[model samples]
Target: MAGVRTSLRRSAPALLIFAAIRALGLVTLILWSHAKGKDPHQLLSARWDSLWYVRVAEHGYDFTLTAPDGRVLSDMAFFPLLPWLEQGVSAISPLGFADSGLLVSALASLFAAWAIFLIGDLLHGRRVGITLVALWGMLPVGIVQSMAYSESLFVALSAWSLYWVLRQRWVAAGILASPAGLTRPVGLAVVAALWVAAACQLARRNGDWRAAANRRMVIGAVLAPLGCAGYVVWVGLERGSLFGYLDVQAEWGNGFDGGVAFAGFILDRLTGPAFLAGAGLLIGVAVAAWAYYLCVKQRQPAALLVYCGIVVGLALCASGYFGSKPRLLMPAFPLLLPPAVWVARARVGVIVAVLSAVSVGSAVYGAFWLNGSGPP
Candidate 1:
């Protein structure tokens, strides 16, 4: 208890910084929306995927929307954990389903920030840890951290799971990974991290079958895949086919096509009128690649390396939803560690000025993004 209290006390500053960043984002959004005669709360709490989560929370899985092109967008495409939390929050509070989702996101994002800070502190130090959390909140889509979405929830679970993995708490890591898998399909990244870390440890131990660490790690490996598998298998049984979940994702035009569609889209943009946008995208990809290279150069833990690799690979390589790729990679927090370390190493004033400027820019960009087409 004393140790937990001490950790929390030390974590308070980082959490405060994270909370302030989120608040700045919300205030910027509110001002921008008001000037444009739009409701900021609605944009944040009930748009795009937010509506689908609300519908599932209120009506269960008995909903589907068909597009003019005859594409079936099944609510099944959404994982259940967010809706489940939304439902529970609504049942207990005066907030409706959408509002409950916003509440869930708000709280979850804080926890996510806490876990991010812990991971950074564990690997580097308190300064890098705090900067890592700040960098996460200053992301271009950091506004989504405050929105009624599952990204925050998944990030929270996955971050803590990774922290535990770094601490070699395999059972705790697996427990968190299970709910993370329930939150989003990317939860597989967490499971992979656990499996890989365990395998690495087992190899190091040279067949220590009776060790408690090995036993717990094996149990964790067994438990980590259950949530995702159970939901997918249930969906399959409901649809009377073993590949029903894949079919559902297919109908929605989502799949892993080795980035062919993504590459083609980029090339088309480069050749077409959106040449600048294409260049910007290429630069973004290059930046992400460089960041991952830095992570490898810094010798991040096997758990973090595997987790980040899976998240980045899936986000970049997955077919369809090209526009949502940035938001999809939101959970790949480890990618920010290198920048976080740089920021930590900077002078205090420089750190403050850069983070403040970037925070405002992120806020304005987020407002513009949401006020415009928004997350589709």
Candidate 2:
């Protein structure tokens, strides 16, 4: 009990610091959007990518598309977890659908920060935990923390699920991962991680197969696959095609067959003075290398390695959604933990000051850039 209290007390400072950084980043984004002569409400409520999510929350699944191609795209193509939360919030509160989405995202962002701290504390120590939260809060793409998007919610769920798995709480891990599956397609990565972790535990046990722990493990194993299966079944029923969700993704130019083609597209733009394209390539490479480093040097848990590899592989090998690579990679926040732990140990004050400056400046720039240029 005393240990639990001490742990909570130590975590409190990191939690408070993360929230403050996130709030600052969010404020910068909102203010920047406002300054661009854009109506904040409209910006918040507008029919961007978020519109599909809002549609799902408000109207449920309806298979229709207005595009020239008679492609049957429905909100079912998106997982229902985030939009369901949005709809639920709006149903109960004075907030409308759009505001509800934002609210869900805001709460999810805080949850994600807390989860990141937990994972970091487990992997490294208290100081590293604080550093990890701070780094996550101040990430260059931190502006997304405030948007009516599912990234925060997904990250929060994914982080905590990983934490539970690390703590050997198989049932809890499986439960958390189920919602994660509903939240994003990457949730399968968590499922895979949990399975691998469980299998390893079972292998190491030199007992009868019907042990009490094995019974609990079997229950967890069954629950882990339900979330993704449920979503897929819903999509099939709504669209009259088992592959309907895959079709919608393809219609949106996000099919998974042309990784090389996408790489060529980026390479074609590399010769000229397209600084943005060059910068994007550099960032992509850097992120990939960093992920690899986490996999190797950090000796990350096997589950985490499998999770990161699967998601990163899918994203990199994916063809049509090349533009969304950064956003897709954003949820891989656990990969940042090893480096953050190192930074936290070496001249903590200097590292914090440097990261804080970079976070604020990059966050402000990212907000403005995203407003003017749109997602890359």
Across 1-376, the per-residue lDDT of candidate 2 in tens digits comes to 9976886677898878877886677677678878886654555455465788888777787645766766555566688898889888988999987889888988898888887888888888878888888877777677677778788898888888888888888788889889999998888988998999888888888644498877777677678878988988777776699887777677766677636866776777786677688668767867776766766678888888888777777777777655567777777776777778678878867986887797788678667756764553
Query: Which RMSD does model 2 reach against the true structure?
Result: 2.4
Per-residue lDDT value at 348 in model 1: 95
CA displacement after TM-score superposition, residue 184 of candidate 2 (Å): 0.9
Deviation from native of the Cα of residue 118 in model 2, angstroms: 1.0
Return the top candidate by TM-score.
1
Per-residue error for 20 in candidate 2, Å, reads 1.5
Predicted structure 1, TM vs. truth = 0.98
Error of 2 at 10 (Å): 2.9
What does candidate 1's lDDT look like per residue over 118-151, in tens digits? 9999999999999999999999989999999999
Off by over 4 Å in 2: 1-8, 44-47, 68-72, 206-208, 273-276
